[model samples]
Target chain A: MLEVRDIHTYYGDSYILQGVSLRVEAGQVVALLGRNGAGKTTTINSIVGLVPPRRGEIVFKGETITRAPPHHIARLGMGLVPQGRRLFPNLTVEENITLAARTGNGSARWTLDAVYALFPRLKERAHNRASQLSGGEQQMVAIARALMTNPDLLLLDEPSEGLAPLLVREIGRVLADLKAQGLSFLLVEQNLHMATAVADWVYVMNKGQIVFEGTPQELLGNEEIKHRYLGV
Target chain B: METLIIQLLNGLVFSMLLFTMAAGLSLIFGQMDVINLAHGSFYLLGGYIGLTMVRRLGSFWLALVVAPLVVGALGLALEYFFLRRLYGRHRHLDQVLFTFGLALIAADLIRWNWGAYVESVPPPELLSGQIPVFTVQFPVYRLSLIAVGVTLALGLGLLLERTRIGAIIRAGVADAEMVSALGIDIHKVFAGVFALGVALAALAGVLGAPVLNLYPGLDFEILILTLVVVVVGGLGTLRGAFFGSLLIGMADTFGKAFLPEFALFLIFAVMAVVLLLRPSGLFGLEGT
Candidate 1:
């Protein structure tokens, strides 16, 4: 479980997230839906300690981790599939996965073998450099690399951003399978259909603030909310 | 035929030495994206420390073994106290200014301690004499230098290609943020890498002092050569550094031997062609 309480984040005196707050329960997939420039990436970055929040607190499993460094936060069982699939271009697929292969919680739920099983294409191109892979394959490698750490909570920022339709559907299936395995997630997604299909709870963000919170059914029924905020 | 063979051997020796210096500089630049003007100062430091050891203990081998360790520790301290704060801030001008100042300071310190006079290291007695190779007499010391340089290069390559830490370093060069996010403390990695780079430069200096001669101004000359190597080999690729060094060394050696008046111009010409054609050096990765 993760709790971000009234956090304010900034980028060199320009305010990005003003008193933003959200939470995700254990074994739940919570969607943070927002349009462009809604501070979604900033929020995710703050939680991961890549961009430390200037004010308020971020707690994970009852411990305040606001001031922790990015590596320390990662070591605390949080895996981040960062936006834009920031894979090591020169490294092989296998090397990329193994680099982050840490059982932070001392559990071997997602080992290299398990990740290979999840994405067999990764095994096929395990020796190929990441730059040689297609966009979808690169995304899979990024996800598998994060999962190799066996994180308690996975943060996926736009997993379907640049994928084809089939790949997007496949990503949704992978999320569903991971959800079945009782792994918690904070997914920042732009695709409403994919988010609704996979997420149990939804939080819509606009202008660095959360404006709506409800179940998938409630969100689907609220046409006015979707149009006004998400522009769906 | 004998003249050609001698020149080729000389080229190989010079290439190996250049590789020893440039490889570390290239890796550090690639991984941290820092233009370390202070790199050659470490090289000078190594030579000075080795000279001291040789003087005190009268042992060439002891100086060779100990000087790099001392210079490497110094490098670690420098990175921790100074270069660590300048990461990810687009402060390259600041980096160059700070490192240039550091280089000047290091040179001044050396000059203050050793005086401004140039010093020469005598080769070990066992390696002092000449040996006939293919009917041409070549100094045993030059041969030893070639052997040591080649051995170090091969050893370093193995350590990089076949180790976990090397993989992490290579990955860090490609994307440092991703490496940091993977739960490896990048600051510690950066410090270790900076020290490692400086150590390589130091080792090259100690090994090379017998042939190159050591003085306060030695840093500037070697720094220019290292820059050429970095540019020709591509910015961040170790293999690029090796190839670039070989090209430069061959050009410098052969040009000086056969065409003395045109050698310097020829070196820059090679660099210009490489830049115009590939711009990334022969072995460097594209777009990085």
Candidate 2:
């Protein structure tokens, strides 16, 4: 479980996440929905300590990782599939995954074989350079790269941003399967359908604040909140 | 015809020497985005230290082993104390200016301690003689440099491409923040790379001493030559550095041998042509 309390983040003088807060229970798929420039990615960056929040605290499982460095935060059992997939273009698919592989807390549940089984397409192109992969394949590589760390929680930032509809559904199915395997994750998304489909609970963000928080059914029924905040 | 062959071999020797120096510059530039003008200072410092070791200990081999280690420790200290303060994409100009200042200081220190006299190390006794090649006698040491350069290129290439550390370094070069978020301490990687880059330069210094010699402004000369190689090869890739060094080294050697008056312009001419054809250098990626 993770708890973010009144976190304020900034990029120089321009305030990004203005006292935003959210949470994810263990083994739950929590979706944070927001429109363009709604501080979704900034929130993720804050939690990962890439841009540490200037205010408030982030409690991951039990440790306070508010001002820790990015790598230290990661070692404290967090994995990030950063926005844009950020794969080392020159590295092979296998190298990209294996580079991030760490044996943390002695729970090596996610190995190369396990992730390959989850996304068999990656195995077929294991030795190919990451730059040569398709968008969907790159996304899979990114996800696989995160899983290789065997972290307690995964933070996914806009995993379906540029994928085709069919591939988006495939990602949704993968998320569902990951959730079934008891993987806790906080997914940032603009895709309402995919978020609502896999997420156990949902938080809608707008202008750097959490504007709505409720069950998926509660969110689906609220047309005004959906239309105004998410622009759906 | 024999003169041409000798000059060609001479070009090969200089190319290998340039590769040894440029590879470090390229790695530092590629991995940390730090344009360390002090790189040349490290080379000069290494050479001066090697000169002292060879004079006092009477062993070129001992100096070869010690100079790099000493310079590498200095590099580690430089990264920790000074260079660490000037990191980030926007602070590149600051890093460059800071390193230039460091180079000036290093040059002065070397002058004060070692004096301004030109000094050269003798080749090891085993490699002291000459071998006949195509009716021309070549220094065995010079010929051995070609072997040394090739071995270093292969060793460095293997260490970077085949090992996990190499994969991490390549990843860091591509996207350091993403690498850290994956549980890697990128700062440690940065420090290690900075040390390694300068150490390689020091190794080149010791290796190149017998031929190039040590003097007051050789640091700047070596620095300029290295910058040309990195620019010609492209930044961030070892292959680029290797090929670029060869191109620039051969051009410089042949130019000096054939058209001595235009020797300085020839290397630049090669660089200009390469840039016109591929703006990113021979092995550099686009937008690097």
Candidate 3:
């Protein structure tokens, strides 16, 4: 489980997350939805300790990690799939995935075989450079790279960005499957259908604050809240 | 024809020496994004240490092994205590200024300790003699430098491209943040890379001592040469550094042999041509 308590994050003097709070229980798929500049990525960054919050505390599994470095946070069983699918462009797909393979204290649930089984296309292009992959394939690589870390909690920032609608649906299905297998994740997204279809609890963000917290059906039912905050 | 062959052999020897020096500089830059202007100082320091080891222990081989270890330890300390503080995109100028200052201080200290006299280490007895190369007698030690350089190039290439740690370093070079986010301690990787880079420079210093003799201002001369190789090859890639060193080394050797007056100018000319054609050097990724 992960919890963020009223964290105020800033990029220099420009305040991004002003009093943002959220929580995700174990095995829950929590989606944070907002339009551009709604501070979704910043929230993920804050949680992963890329840009630590100046105020408030983040508790991951029981420990306070608001001021921890990104690597330390990662070692504590948290993986982040960043916004841009920042794969090492020159590295092969296998190298990219293998680079993130860590055998922490856990029994190592995710292996190269498991990742390849999840995305068979990646295996076909195992030796190909990351830059040579399609957007959807790169997204799969990004997700696979994170999963290789064997994270207890995965934080994804815009996993569906720039992918085709069909690819988005496929990603949504993958997330649903992963949730079924008991992986906790906080997904930041602009895609309403993907988020609603996959997420167990949805938190709609607006201006760096959580505006709505409800089930996916509740979020879809409330048209005013969806249109005002998420631009859905 | 004999003179041309001799010069070509000389160029090859010098090219290998330059490769040994440039490999470290390129890797350090590639991994940490820190332009260590003090690289040549590390080389000179290694040479001086090697000089002492060779003289005291009466063993060139011993110096070759010991100098890198000493310089590498110093590099590790420098990274941990000083270099780690100035790591960031906006703090690049600070890194340059700091390393430049270290170079100046090192130059003064080396002079203060070793004095301003030109000192050269004799090649080990086994590698001291000369062998015929196309009607010209080339020193065996110099010829051996080519082998050493090639072996080092292959070793470093394998280390960077094949191994797990190498994968991590390559990944770090591309996206350090993501590497760290994968539960890797990237700062340690940076520190290790810095040590390796400086150690290579030191190794080059000891290796080049016989042919390039240590004297006043040689650090800057070697520094400039290493910089040229790195820039001409492109930045942050081993292939770039290796090929760049060869190109610059040959150009300088041939230029000095034929047109001594314009020798330095010729190296820059090759660099200018390379840049004009491919701004990122031979193997550099775009926008790097």
Candidate 4:
């Protein structure tokens, strides 16, 4: 449901993403796997117009949205659980979620009640400021905040980056549940196990370019590809 | 005993006025990280505009309402045309330089129009006399100013604490990028906030003009006081501004009243103590 084609992004004068391209179909979890400095986050940011691509196009549900502002892109049913879970440190858990609430596509599936049901710990700590929460709890709040937008395409950048194993597993379960609900996702992950477990398709990126694309089973079976590119 | 009581009332009145001017300055700095050297220009603009309105209509209340709107529009224009382009550039010095230039320009404009002479506005009829309290008589207008300042403070506190827009503003202050990503048009938010802050300063100026007097150089005087307030209150805390104003206000008032020769030293002395103790102001958050 989302297409990013030959996008170039820059941070100051340094070109971070060099003609990177990817696609995610409806009701699919597509993994963009890469090592450090692979431009995965840059690709995601370019799509959301956080770091607008200087070249190429981004299309979402048949509309070219390359030049749209970040808020406008967000309003167009794309949610980003940004790396580091950049929650408002002073806002309460509930405020963080409700602040992003929008009926972008007239879908009410991801309301406050729905989010609370997904993370009951958030409901219990709804009144506590985001900084008061543990890292895992903060991640949950960040996810729930993005979900409140009821986005058509959710971009998750390193959701499991700093979480414990148990929290990572819980995050995996949440992604599985979200996949069952027919939400498309472009997940940028460093954890191969979690990516393989949740993602239907995989694209390995190296040196600002996508080098491999296949079904998760195909990539798992290709030992040479994993050893050379992913070191797994 | 009468002199002490009169000085006590004077301290309260001055503290309240300081609160009015400092609160908006604190919010703008805290939320946008904009130093806004032009803030005092808005205050000066308010007094000049209010002077004109009061002269034409002979009504303090009318000037109070009209002056802020004019100064606020000016602030909105400044944000849209100038300050919006400087975001996230570590352009703090550039912002200071630009706004300091703007302050100088504003002062020049006021001078060109009103000249350098100090002009005074008399209190309205109801507030023209003094009210006796215990053996001291206080100017009814000063007491009225204290009442208005307190009311505005409470109203602002409620607006920040209880309203959804206030919640968004507070959130924006903490992480503006996150707020923008959450479907908020931060450009619009920033403009509106800057305008609101300017309007508050204007309102304080109009309310205070009768006491402080109107002159072109008034901007520099109030600007220094505002810097002191912001520094002592920490950068972004509203509560800090309030308490800091009170501390400075009381110090300035009682020091001048009791020890006229050392009153200026008292203001700096209080700031020194605060710096030695907290370094971030009395209520400001550290590393903000």
In order, what DockQ does each candidate have?
A: 0.83, 0.93, 0.83, 0.71
TM-scores of the first chain across all predictions?
A: 0.98, 0.98, 0.98, 0.97
Backbone clashes in model 2, listed as residue pairs: none
Interface RMSDs of all predictions? 0.8, 0.5, 0.9, 1.0
Candidate 2: tens digits of C-alpha lDDT, residues A151-222: 889999999989999999999999899999999999999999999999989999999999999999999999
Which 10-residue window of candidate 4 chain B scores lowest in summed lDDT? B279-288
- Candidate 1 residue-wise lDDT, B90-176, digit = tens: 789989999999999999999999889889999888899899998899989998877877777778778776787888988988888
Estimated TM-score for each candidate: 0.97, 0.99, 0.99, 0.96
Q: Model 3: per-residue lDDT, tens digit, A1-232?
A: 8999999999989999999999999989999999999999999989888889999999998999999998889989998899999999989999999887887775898999999999999999999999999999999999999999999998989999999989998898899889989999999999998888889999998898999999999999999998788775
Candidate 4's C-alpha runs over 4 A off are B259-261
The alpha-carbon root-mean-square deviation between model 1 and the true structure, to one decimal in Å, is 1.4
Candidates sorted by TM-score, best first: 2, 3, 1, 4
Better of 2 and 4 by lDDT: 2
Candidate 4 residues A1-232, lDDT tens each? 8988998889989988888888999999999998888899888888888889899999999889998988888888889999999988877888888887887666578888899999999999999999899999999998999999889889999999989999999999999999998999999999999999989899999888898999999989999888877888
Residues forming the 10-long window of minimal summed lDDT in candidate 4 chain A: A99-108
Candidates arranged by DockQ, highest first: 2, 3, 1, 4
Question: Model 3: per-residue lDDT, tens digit, B20-75?
Answer: 88999988988999999999999999999999999899999989999999999999
Candidate 1, A1-232: lDDT as tens digits: 8999999999988899988989999999999998999999999999999899999999998889998988998988899999999998878899899987886545688888899999999999999999999989999998999999889999999999989999999999999999999999999999999999989999999888898999989999999999998897
Candidate 3 recovers what fraction of true contacts?
0.80
The global Cα lDDT (0 to 1) of model 4 is 0.87
lDDT of 4 by residue, B25-133 (tens): 8888877888888888899899888989888899988888988899889889999999998877478988899899999998998899989998998877768999887
Residue B226 of model 3, lDDT score: 94
True contacts kept of each: 0.78, 0.90, 0.80, 0.61
